[model samples]
Target: MSLLDEKQRGAILRALHDLRRAAPARPGEQYGAPGNGSSLLLSLVTVGLVFALWYVATNVGWIKPLFLPSPQAVWMQLMDVASDGFADASLLSHIGWSAFRVFGAFVLAACTAIPVGIMMGVNRVARGVLDPLVEFYRPLPPLAYLPLVVIWMGIGEGSKVLLIYLAMFAPLALSARAGVKSVAIEQIHAAYSMGASRGQVLRHVIMPAALPEILTGMRIAIGFGWTTLVAAEMVAATAGLGFMVLTASKFMATDVVIMGILVIGAMALLFDLGMRWLERRLVPWKGKA
Candidate 1:
């Protein structure tokens, strides 16, 4: 009962596919596409230009070495720190310590904050109770409460972890709450019509919808955790990248300071990349309109 022969139908389908392939992605659609290679090349080119400029500026003495050490000097300092150690510990040890504090606090915050945020989104009472507290402290800088944290928890690893934890908690919680609230009412109603229980609805409907936001929150929370690391390590910290950088500054080791900064930046960037990969794996539909 076909209106046309197989060849005509096949030709129409092929044309439709070609049209789709040629179409540009709309805004808030695909996160990446086949053309990503060009974008990556541009990024690499930009980085190369920046480094070239830095090299020229330093070698030409356009900028003082004190303010900005040459990239060569920074690299030499990195090698020295890696092999001979810095601030009474190897570079790896400092990195390990800093990672321990940042990631431990990050994990703790994610575990606690996400659930609280979900509760806040789902229940007015929970929202009422926690909203004021989260809002009150979130705007305060870590330095503002560092002294209080030290006084209460003492200058131990516990205090450092807690400091970073507090920094991350608010953002994660808020993001999760926002994610839950963003879930469409129609989705909930559809789930309910299918005889889904409250628990099932949350598990299947709300959680998936909210996952993208929660993942985004985790990314933000980790950044906050890293930001708080230096403040945390300031409290009686013998070994950490933050401590090393602080110590080096006292001795006016600009190269060491720059090296530490680069190392930290690299680590943070790696974590962000990991988060992005996870987001793609868990919610490939994200960014779609």
Candidate 2:
């Protein structure tokens, strides 16, 4: 008995060792997963390389200053904008306006689209009704509808927000629908077997299962909101990063154009990072099959 017990324990230990060797610490992750530090270092290196290339190109006159401003020129313009303001508004005000427009539209879209998407995913009638509308408009560019929106809403903040909201809606809706549909049938069956009501199952299972996709949709929707922002702001008046960039372009202020572009990119990047952090917090089980 003692001998048998010893052999069993050795076998179990060896099996555990083999299992550890065969599987990644996080299942479905690559064998040599890069930690957050590694990813940050790589991102920094890439940014540094791009900056170096830009500096060298400008210094060597590979690209004309008019067409491609030097880093120093753009940086100087940034400082000027920060201190003295541009287009009758400070840099911070421009950012604030843009952020307001983008986030406001995004919030509205998420509120409406997520529910509509879930309905479409779960109900045949809802799918029939809304899917056609979404598909019909999804392929159309914001520019195509810009004039109509301006005519209807009359060059105000209402029109601008609506344009961005429309741009963000289809993607958010589609992502939610996909997420709901992707929930495992087995899970649904098990829930039913355990006496779960339809509402309870949805609340407890479907919503959680669909959350990652919904969050992903939110991220994509925000990106679309930003892309449509330039067009939306074009309708109107003033005081946004998009407006600053467009105004600069008309005056042939390439340095300001570049600065505005960099600022927009940085803000978008930061929002995306926030979305990623939110995803990790809300859907920790994602990609961890």
Candidate 3:
């Protein structure tokens, strides 16, 4: 070989050796993974940074107090609402009312949607009947249906609950159906080969397999339900966090408005955390290889 060709061959061999040495011990090997402690620390740092920014912006008068209240001002308003009450109802009472409406509608949606979704997945008739309806209303914004809901159900608790229920139902049902459709055909065949009855197969095989998806659907549904709360409470509500926020805004009670917004966000965060915890506990095998 010529001198340059010999040098090029040596360089290629060295590069291949280096690349092999740097490769993972096994295919798909993960490295430098952060532990739970690292994750928690990062979360805390992010929250601290956000609060610091908020403090600096308000304290430095970067934003008008009328438009953006200081964190301290919002905190004081929270204390006032807790003690003196907002619109003759305590903060706890408003929270309770909002929670009641959300959970009520959510539970109703879960009970109905899950079964309908399973039927849709398992039976062509059900799919043909319900899929069109679900697809139709799912795309429409909640506000589009609000006037009709109010006219039909009147401006009462029934209307609010129904509106929230409608908001939660479609996504949940679709999730359940998708879950059922995703069930392994081999699992169904195995159950049938073992002489398991239809009911037995559904209960033991289908339900467990579909539970993770159903729970995920529930989480998404609750989020939608919460989003619908302000719209629901706009319908003649006497006591709710939404009502409190809207009432405060009319008079430009900026602190109270910010406080109410914070309370709603905090509650939603807590509930979401609870749902995540439940999912981890109940669906331990989810996403496992």
Q: Predictions ranked by TM-score, top down?
A: 2, 1, 3
User: Which has the higher TM-score value, candidate number 1 or candidate number 2?
Assistant: 2
Q: Report the C-alpha lDDT of model 1 over 1-289, residue by residue, as the tens digit.
A: 2544344435533543454356566443365444657878988999999999999999899999898999999999999999999977999999999999999999899999999999999999999999999999999999999999999999889999999999999999999999999987876776566555687678767888899999999999999988888889999999998998889999989999989988998999999999999998987666654
**Against the hidden reference, what TM-scores do the models get?**
0.89, 0.90, 0.87
The residue pairs found clashing in candidate 3 are: none
What local distance difference test score does each model get? 0.88, 0.88, 0.87
Please give, for residues 1-289, the per-residue lDDT of candidate 2 as tens digits: 4675555445544543443355434552556678778999999999999999999999899999999999999999999999999999999999999999999999899999999999999999999999999999998999999999989999889999999999999999999999999987876776666555687668767888899999999988999998888888897668999999999999999999999999988989999999999988877667753
Q: Model 3, which residues run further than 4 Å from truth?
A: 1-32
> Which 10-residue window of candidate 1 scores lowest in summed lDDT?
11-20
RMSD of 1: 8.4
